[model samples]
Target: MNLYLLRHTQPDVAPGICYGQTDLGLAASFDAELQRIRAGLAEVHVDHVHSSPLQRCQRLAAALAAGKVHQDPRLMELDFGEWELQLWETIPRGLVEVWTEDYVQHAPPGGESFFDLQQRAISFFDEVSANNEDLLVVTHAGVIRALLAHALNMQLLDAFRLRVDYGSLSQLELQDGRVTVSAVNRRF
Candidate 1:
């Protein structure tokens, strides 16, 4: 299985707003960014296309997948819960501090933690990665980072070290039951 991961373009939201499973739209630069992403993926053969249900990812996935995109909730971004749509600075500093100090286990007021996000993302990855097929997944940075961390056997804490830029592409190859990280954060 060869997995290609593409993060959505910059969301149509103001800077510093916390969004997760927020169903945000694409930015004005979406068309241009999609063109670049298409150009970058022109040579890559994709047999299956999957994406997060969020509109930001859906637009790109639909464009790239020729209208057939498998929307999976497991691939959605981390749920921000009470923090969704709130400016990061406006969220209680103490709450933010707690989450920042240990994000892996700490869940936002009504949301799941980073660890929770990893579990669902990795579960979806495991389910789809067992076959000898080329899979393209359009998802969020958090999901991409979690998958990368799993493939590389890196600690979850270190997953943040992997940079996943908007409109970036990453690749993972699985052969003989072993997975290899072919690329990471290749932006067009």
Candidate 2:
């Protein structure tokens, strides 16, 4: 199985706002970025393409998916709920303390926890691994982090350490139930 995890192009969001699953559009200059990503992936011969339902990812997936574009809710970004659209720096100190102390345990009001995301990601991986074919996944930074955590056998909390840049590519290959991380955070 060859998995190509592609992070979406830049989003149209204010610098401090937390915009998970907000359905924001791409940045104005995304065309050039998309062209670069498409060109970088020209030789992959993708057999399947998957994406989160969010427009930011779906738009990019539609353009890159020469084979099939499948939307999976399990691939969506972690919902920030009350924190959505709020500047991180401006969040109340008490909330920040709670978040910092136990992000995996603390579910944002009406949202999801990091551990919840890990479970969803694990389920998605199980489905994908069964197919064992080349796949292109267009998704959010959080999805990429979850995928990396699964591939590298890292703790869910450790997922925060991985940096998934916009328009970057990460590759994971699986053979006979064994996994190998071929590359990560490769810019086009």
Highest lDDT: which candidate?
1
lDDT of 2 at 31: 95
Instruction: Please give, for residues 6-102, the per-residue lDDT of candidate 2 as tens digits.
Output: 9999999879888787889999979999999999998887788999999999999999877669999999998998888989888787887888788
Q: Residue 139 error for model 1, in Å?
A: 0.1
Error of 2 at 72 (Å): 0.5
State which candidate has the highest TM-score: 1
Return the lDDT, model 2, position 188.
Answer: 90
lDDT of 2 at 34: 93
Runs with alpha carbons beyond 4 Å of true place in candidate 2 = none
TM-score of each: 0.98, 0.96
What would the per-residue lDDT of candidate 1 be over residues 133-153, giving only the tens digit for each residue? 899999999999999999999
Clashing pairs in 1: none
